[model samples]
Target: MAKGKEARVMIILECTTCIRKSENQKSPGISRYISQKNRHNTPSRLELKKFCPYCYKHTIHVEIKK
Candidate 1:
């Protein structure tokens, strides 16, 4: 049987730049990416550089807990 917490967890990655820009500028919303990671394999939060259409550039996307 698969334990609830043992399965790969789904996380959301939001663009850091987009978040900052939203504070100063009027924008639609934050850019977020959905991904999965194994809890056992990656004990720490995952971060990736991804393209943000709203920001029109690449920015650091940090993992956010639900």
Candidate 2:
């Protein structure tokens, strides 16, 4: 059986840049999906994919201490 507390994560989504825009916004696609599922389902420990704002792509992520 698995042990220890489940790692907390900050789901950072990809950022979009436009010539007419000065700032980029984080995408909500992955965050919404993960949050929705986590709300209604049992929790489990596993590596997950999250969109990176800086990278502008889906990237594998591990928990980091703030």
Using lDDT as the measure, the top candidate is 1
The 10-residue segment of model 2 with minimum total lDDT is: 12-21
TM-score of 2: 0.30
Candidate 2 segments whose C-alpha is farther than 4 A from its true place = 1-46
Query: Mind giving the per-residue lDDT tens digits that candidate 2 earns over 1-66?
Result: 994644544332222222113345543333212332232242443345766554565666543223
Q: Write out the backbone clash pairs for model 1.
A: none
**Cα-based lDDT for every prediction:** 0.88, 0.39
Instruction: Estimate, for each residue in 1-66, the C-alpha lDDT of model 1 and write its tens digit.
Output: 766566587899999888887889888789999999888999898999999888788889999878
How many residue pairs clash in all the candidates, one count each?
A: 0, 0
Q: Which stretches of candidate 1 lie above 4 Å from their native place?
A: 1-4
On the 0 to 100 scale, the lDDT of residue 8 in model 1 is 89
Given candidate 1, what's the lDDT at residue 54? 86
